[model samples]
Target chain A: MKINFPHRQFAHCESGVTANLLNYHGFPCSEAMAFGIGGGLFFAYVPFVKINFLPLTTYRIGPGSIFAKATRRLGIKVIKKKFGSPESAENELDRLLEAGRPVGAQTGVFWLPFFPPAYRFHFNGHNLVVIGKEGSDYLISDPIFEETVRCPAADLRKARFAKGALAPKGRIYYIEKMPVHFNLPKAIESGIRDVCRVMLKVPLPLLGVRGIRLLARQLAKWPDRFGEKQSLLHLGHVIRMQEEIGTGGAGFRFIYAAFLQEAAGVLENDRLIDLSRRCTAVGDLWRDFALLASRVCKGRAVGQDSFDHLAALLSSCAVHEEALFEDLRSALVR
Target chain B: MKKNDVPQHSGLLSGNREVNYAVDVDGRYILESSVGWEAKNIALRQAWEAIADELTVVLAEIKDGKKSALAYHMVKNQMDPALLSQYSGVARWRIKRHLKPAVFAGLRPADVVPYAELFGISVDELRFVPEELISPLAGLDQVEADNS
Candidate 1:
């Protein structure tokens, strides 16, 4: 028997899962609200970390973070687990599904058979909800898609235990108890403050707004250091991380802007609504950087759009984001 | 982003339309269904091209018998020796050594079982790659035909 679970798509997976799961448990939450309340925005360009032989350029916090943070702040008790073996993991998941509790599962994108073959890569951190099991297939509520999906139990097992870099190890989580009384305004305030603090005050140069600048510096030097082919590959990875597979670059910014717009209504603060528009403007700058960088990657730029110019465009994003976050902090103060 | 400005095109080749946040008439943020965007597609294409390039080079090396079938599988799966070792419980050095055609040829069925299991193939299937590693971009044409 399939548990009746409402499936709704969102721009990002973790937030979407959180929103859907919370909505199921009696708290009506949108994906944007979940993301904003969780303070899911992050920017890190660490050269030391490598994925598929390229340096890491992540736009948001890793998977599972949003659900964990959003739920914790909202005073929802959740049971989270990671099994040592795939067999144990499968048993636990099956048990939960039998009990009529829809489970949030973390899996690698590569082994999920339902995904478009071209889009499947070995990136290990993807989230989905499994609501039912019937005749060797599990029904899935993957947040990135419009409708629900299904996966064979064997393939689902493989995806859950997919190895290498952020392996899921068959991790499963679900809410234990949803809080009926929690401070929504305080949650919104803390979440916005966390975003501002991380954006503006992170001491590390390879994180926050500072990280954007670091990426800018490294990006300009790529052509000389790694040659044209490798530099273009690096550029492509950055764009993919931003816009591909819902990693949330400019897409995330717009989502956050939407969240802020909603936050304004809840808090009855007009400044927040204004700040949300500025957030969108900052997101636009990021989109501009992606467009220009893509042209550079395609070698379609005739002139004035060199890596140096791209660097300037990216640095501009960092500058504007810094300003936006600083303004956000003051907006939260009153 | 304006709702009108949202890219209504589906993914470059994925045949998926995704929700993107844009603004409505009164400037409220609304989720728009984006077919896809040119810039994002180009980036995705570059990745596929890189994979195709590496596969071509690896396939040539295998034809020359300098590398084993395992080498082709590894590159095709985007796995390095270190990563493959971690998953298959084989030592990285041994994985690298096994990539040599002669060494792979000397391996027994039992010795190849771990790799076959990891790749979800039989020991015999692991012994050789197909004549062609089809470019993922070509799948779009297949998808188009299926739709039509």
Candidate 2:
């Protein structure tokens, strides 16, 4: 609940979205974005189809697979840093790991935060990405999956991962560009990289738009001297500077509800009712019914329910019969 | 129903002198002979409505292909084995013991097909009845299905 932004670098909508989307498509765990997007996709049962989640594993990247392809497809670079407590040996490996990178580069530095007692669920071990900086505060997209939050760079003064004499007192986790393959599926690569596409937060354009623009601006400030596309940063700045526009962003809320209904329904069809039960973002009953219909389409055994049976379930939620049937019919096409 | 008067056995209890049997398919015997004998006809004609009734149901189910006919071993698997033993008038183990001989006595090797025709269950599932006893089970099924 305590959201804090950590210092980090840039993010792109098109590449990041497409890459991670592709990576998560076949993954057993649903895909979620740190900010902007909160919901992840999952298929409960594949009547005939099957997919392996191994391609998404961090340890398996190589030349020909989708993992390697994502790095090559997008110009995203990766860096890794390991942390050690200074009270131990005099090994120079820890210093060498943290020394070389340019200080203000628009780089996503992966670092281990000071293990907070409040955040320790399973041992204090964690992995996080620092994507931007606001004054002295580090803007981060933590993969903690709770909420996108920020914390002070000075907080890292106690940071075990930093390099110093007592630096060995803390630990440093491996940092890298969120492996692009870890971001999007290949199909939607060009359209929405860098921007986090969360179905749950789809209606909140402010959060979605602000999060991405800040990332773009941060990336633009990177010292790596590539003038490839300056227009991207300008656009990011324009949007990031805006006030809470359009009816306190209520239209965004409507769209968010529609998406939630669809997403929750998607979750239900997969027998993932627990996820729907946990969701508090959306308020639409038709979406819930659609989730049920989606389950049947995904080949779950809902027992002898025909199209008429489907329409009857939808009717309970006050959805029009024709529209319900149409949605049910369409869910099957996938 | 025609009944057979009790046969006389020497070791009898004080009050009861008769213990009647109702045998329709041929007759029931309490013989101690070690050797088998050829056919010798002794007529005590009685109609067994049981055998006639069961055969009627089995024949109908078979004709319509609702029941896939199988060899004794496979049929034994589907039916309750205890029932089969009771119908055959044999000890339970003897039912398993004589199964091959029973199947071979009535049917040819080419007659039984595997999964395509009948489901292969264990021999325990079979309900055995001598040709005469099958009727009561058939009536039971009809009664139960009707009630359901």
Candidate 3:
């Protein structure tokens, strides 16, 4: 019989094994048997031997971005400073697995419908695990695990949830592989890919930039019904305006430019909707404000770095657009 | 164990011993050979390509007129076509039909102004706008500002 040890900070595979064995039959989360069994396993282990799935200890959450996503994965990759290409992440995964540690990572990338449309813009926090793999399918363990799953690495890269930010950024951890003789044979599967991603249900009006961006263009005008705190309401309108152009997907620039004309007028109103037609340039509102604020005030402020980072990403996107158009025009001529 | 000495199940199969022995050997051979599988994923890429092209044509038709502005809600995203149509004013059939094609063809149908309106901006200005920036959100410069 396998010897059982007391729970410790770092759990060994033996402990995990015993936990799995005793809990395997059918153990409830809050039961005395469950706690005594699982917690006892957690407490009596030495460092580097025990593997614990503690949410706060390993994972982190923050703003999402193309560059940040790449940097996060860099934390675990061997022999690399920058997680440069998709191929590089693959190489990193291979190296890590061959070395016997199973890694968990979250990419800013996301799938559409993972959240309501209002929560789509720049909202972060997605967790996923790299549960080894075979062939074209990467075995994954997600929080909403219903069954063990295998998905094409390429498809995972392309998921909208990755939000085009396809590298680990949110959360990360790893478990060292057991000795060969004692290693557990992988079972048929344990979890499903139908992830139950957590969604924070906040009031619609309280939702920041994205909410406002949608309302401005879709509503024809921002609603005055919310009333008072017009600047806050105006801020909501501005966010809606931004959403029209934010890095949503291809062919969105034209929509942003067109709607900017309408959203600006909304900003100038008593309720920010009456003069919605006259507003032609929405960038005028923040570009000067941002530049002047940066020059005048030398302190860090909330949304300051976010504003700059997003602006830079947006600019890069613009340059990419120019290149595509040039290529298209040249193609047409040829 | 050697080629001709099997006797345990032969008593049960006395009526047809030769056939049962042949069947057991064949089943074992098949089970061993099936340990690995052949790759057949070409079908998936082909399906995507066919679906994408058809979708682009459908999207072009849907955003042909006034509804072109609401194209963002209707095209390329993973949302249900019917859901998008509720907001986009284009019919759901058009969205389902055209979405993949628009994405595959490198067109953002949701951001595209009607072909008639494309002439409003100078070709140079059109050149200035990124295809990506053509979404209903960012395509309109003024709107992006407010949202930012």
Candidate 4:
């Protein structure tokens, strides 16, 4: 017996899953609302950490943070579990399905058979909902896909237990309780404030706006230091992380812009609308950056001057974001 | 991006195969499966090509007995030693030891089982590098060129 959970395709996984789960529990949450309330938008470029041998570039906060923060803000109680063995994980998932609970799970993308061949990679932080089990196949709602899909039990097991960076370890989470009413304005304000602190107030040079500037500095030197092929790969990785892998459109700048537009309506604040437009412009700049970077990746070298131009573009984005978030923080305080 | 500004393909072969998430004309968030999505796919394919090229070299090293088949599979699967260690529940040092051709040849079935399972291959298959591993991107270049 499966709970008739609605499957809606979304841009990003965690925020999408959080929105679907919250809606299933009677919250009627939108994806943007969930993302905003969770304070999901973020950026960090840590050269020391690597994913697939390239420097770490992330468009959103760490995996699972959105769901955790959103639920906490909205007063939704959730039960999260990680298993030591695949057998126990499968058993628990089956048990949950039998009890009519649509469980949210974190699994590696590489082992999931339903994903398009090109999209399948060894990304362990991918999130989906296991809505039902029929014999040896489990029905899954992967937010990135166009529709619901089914995965064989064995493949599901492999994906859930895939080893690597950000391994899920057979993690499953589900809402245990939902509040009758949530204070949307308070949660939105809190989310806005927190993001402002992260983007504008964070002191570390390796994070927030400073991190973007650092990435820019390093990007400018990539062509000279690593030569053409390696430099292109580095540039390609940055664009791939920004556009392709669960970015929710334009490195999450568009999503954050959408959130700001929604917040403007909710809080009846005109300033947020202005910030939303500015954020959208930043998203456009990121798109332009990706287009240029993709051209470089395809062996169409635009010369060394192109690298400097791209770095300047990134720096401008950082500056605009820093100012926008600062304004948001002060507006929320008022 | 605006709806009008969104890239659209027009020609004899005109259909959007890739899906993208963007805002629609109604100011509602929607998924637009458009030809523009292929741009990102091309980028992704290039990244994979680089990895496949590395794996090709690693496979040759394995075949020449310079490195073990474990090294070939690890590179083919886009995994590093630390990641393989986590997946197999094997200690990093032991995994490193198993990367030597001599050490890998002498490994017991029990020792080889976890790596095989992680790679979704049999023990024998894990011990021998496959032919496809040598030139993994053989036809990929043609497919990409055709797409462009």
Candidate 5:
């Protein structure tokens, strides 16, 4: 069974999946718009949580939130399910495909056979669309890749049911209803408000702008506390999360900047234009920090690249992000 | 970032292009495609180097008969006993015991099927290990992150 769904490749997964599903339902959402409306951008340096045996330093919020939040904000209705059994999940997915509805699935990447060797890891947060099935292979529209691919039924089952942190648990979702029209300005404003509020005012030192500053303070003493080699390893891990793991570089700051520009046009607020530029500047600072930290990771000698210097760069990002979010909060307050 | 400053490095994401928001000549934001970035590549290489170092130690232990081939395979997959046990449906204590060559050698075919299937290898090939140390993780002809 196959349906004629036009698939567009995107830089990130959940937002792309949201955009594609909404467009298919005739809602006509762009990826950046979906990301912005969903409040997709976030930062947290949770040192206690472990991924790949290192601290989890996520560039974005937890997986699956973008789709759920974006759909909610746009006033679209979706049916989502997580099945306890692989058999039931496969049956439901096959029924949906036979009914000619394209379904979005949350899957573990490690068991997905179509991924290139380098991209295969134990990450369970990857999102893709099951557009159709031919014989036993399911058609996949993975946003990160340039084109659609295919995975066999058994492998798809394994991916859907893979065990680990953030396991997908045979999850599937599809749009159930599309509104005639949405209050675009309202949605945009609400998204901007939520992001600004969380980034600036969250009480936990581990959560928001406070999190970045906390990371900065702790990073300076990592070499003394954890020793040089371990500190470099953590530095390298943070750099990868900041630069490599699907953030469009600089930790999605540029993406949010682009969103702010579009939000300005939609909301007819010129102040957002200035905030957009400042956000872009903050993104540049993060790129600078990542570049310096990568150097620090490479310069393994005890004091070759001063951890203090790297910490200073990170502190500047925290400083600028605090200012940018403060301005955004005030911009929305009026 | 400006459109010109995006680094098109040949690294981990070789042959695959990702979208970046860059400012064009008009200073308007446009989605630009990038092959890779140097800092990301370094970070990736750094991670794979640490993995490679761990695998090297595991391989030496495997050769010295202090550890079993399961130990080498586990390290290659970046799994410790707890993680391997989760995936393979083996108990943690049993996994630790199986990491010894003497215990692994006496195990029956049925006892190893879970692991062999978990790693997507045949029971016999689960014992396979590369002869030498490996390089960075991005791209390589010899150690291409494949268990097939």
Candidate 6:
């Protein structure tokens, strides 16, 4: 049995899955729209929280927030369940498939057999939609893939139940109700305000723009503290978090820029178009930082000057982002 | 990024390579597969090499009886004790205790099942460090072959 769900490949997994599922349910949500409404853009450079033993440097909000926030703002009803046992989770997922409801699930990338071996890692928090089940294979709509794919039942189960940080624990979610109408402008305003607050007003020195500055300070000291090879590894990890891990492009700045462009149309506001362009420019700056950092990582450059240059780039990014979000907030407020 | 700036294909020879972003003719962003970006590929290789280095140190520690094989697998799987506890249905304290080489050596088969399953290896394999754990670049050769 299959639901004939349309699969659209997207840059980021959670927002893409949210948009696809919402569109499938007749809400016509685009990936950018879902991302914007969900307040997906964020920055945090937490030194204490370790990912793969390095400081956690995330470019966006945590997983599952986009889906939850977008659904809530749009007045969509959804059922979310996490199972304690694999058996109950599989049984329930099968039951949902039999009833023709496409389900969104959180899974670990490492356990999914369809993934290229190089892409498989211990990092969890991958999101996918299960559209069908045919005997032993489960039809999967993983957002990051270029096309929909299939997974064996055993692989699917293991992925869903994969152990480790951010484990899915057999989590499954699906829409139970769809709102007939929602206030696009209000939601957009709310989303903009939320992002502005996070970027500009978050009190923590380890989060928001402050966190970026903190990262810059710490990053500049890496060579002195950890030596050349280890410092390069640290730099490489930052790039990986920005470019390779689930970020659509330019550490999600491009995606959020796309969202702002769409918002300009939805709210019929000209200022947002200007902000969108600025956001794209910010994305370019992030790309520049990545390029430079990549050079350092590859051993093409070594010196205090190179590290200082990278740290300067991050500081500039933080300043630009702070100003951009402030402008967005003011534009929405008026 | 502009449509013109998007690389049509990746040039990476090893590691997990894919380009998840591109641009359409109209300059709209699109999702596309890429072999890998050159700089990113280099950085990823270095990152993996760093992990391999960490694993090497971890394996030596386990072999020297300073820590359990669990510590070796933990680093190999990129996990910490907190995360392992969450997956293994074991308490953090107990998991920490199990990290001692003495306690780990004394653990029965049943006690090791959850961890063995979590790492997708047999209990016997879990008890001893796998050969792949010795070199962090265990699978990159195959990736290079596939790319070639």
Give me the candidate number with maximum DockQ.
1
Expressed as tens digits, the lDDT of each residue in A9-62 for candidate 3 is: 101111222223223222211111111112110001111221111011111112
* CA lDDT scores, all candidates in order: 0.87, 0.27, 0.28, 0.81, 0.83, 0.82
State the weakest 10-residue window (summed lDDT) of model 3 chain B.
B29-38
lDDT per residue as tens, model 6, A142-210: 877767889999888988988755778899999998877788888877887888888889899987889
The regions of model 5 sitting more than 4 angstroms off are A300-305, B133-148
Error of 1 at A53 (Å): 1.5
* Tens digits of lDDT, candidate 1, A181-200: 98888888888898888878
Whole-structure CA lDDT of model 6 = 0.82
Q: Can you tell me the DockQ of model 6? A: 0.45
Give the alpha carbon lDDT tens digit for every residue of A1-334 in model 2.
1123222211221112222333323222211121112221110111122111001101011111222234334444433233343333113322322342211111112122322211111111123434344555654444322234465654432233422111223332222343425433332222112112321134532233222232333333322332322222221112211101110011122222222233334333432222222221221232333334334333352333333444454233222322332333233333
Residue A51 of model 5: what lDDT? Answer: 76
Candidate 6 chain A, which ten residues in sequence have the lowest lDDT sum? A115-124
Q: Number of the top candidate by TM-score? A: 1
Give Cα distance to truth, residue A176, candidate 1, Å: 0.2
Per-residue accuracy of model 4 over A1-334 as CA lDDT, tens digit each: 4569998877788888999988888888778888899999888998888777888888788888889989998888889999989899999999999999999999988898776555667888899999998879999887776678899999999999987678788999999988888898989888887787787677888788888999999999998999988888899889878877467658888878888888999999989888887888888888888887877778665668889988999999898888888777777755
Predicted candidate 5 versus true structure: per-residue lDDT over A1-334, tens digit per residue: 7788878877788888988888888877777888889888888889987778888887677888888888888888889999989899999999999999999999988788777555566788889999999999999888777888889999999899887778888999999888888988888888877787778787888867888888888898898888877888898889877877467768889888988988988888899989988988999999988888877777743473478887788788888888898889788766
True contacts recovered per prediction: 0.60, 0.00, 0.00, 0.36, 0.58, 0.53
Q: What's model 1's lDDT at B100?
A: 95
* Candidate 6 ranges beyond 4 A from true positions: B8-33, B61-72, B90-107, B128-138
Q: Candidate 1 vs candidate 3: which has greater TM-score?
A: 1
Clashing pairs in 1: B8-B35, B9-B35, B9-B36, B10-B35
TM for chain B in all models? Answer: 0.90, 0.23, 0.25, 0.75, 0.87, 0.78
Give i-RMS (Å) per prediction. Answer: 1.6, 42.5, 30.5, 4.3, 1.6, 3.1
Model 1, runs deviating above 4 Å: A247-251, A302-305, B144-148
Candidate 5: residue A294 lDDT (0-100): 78
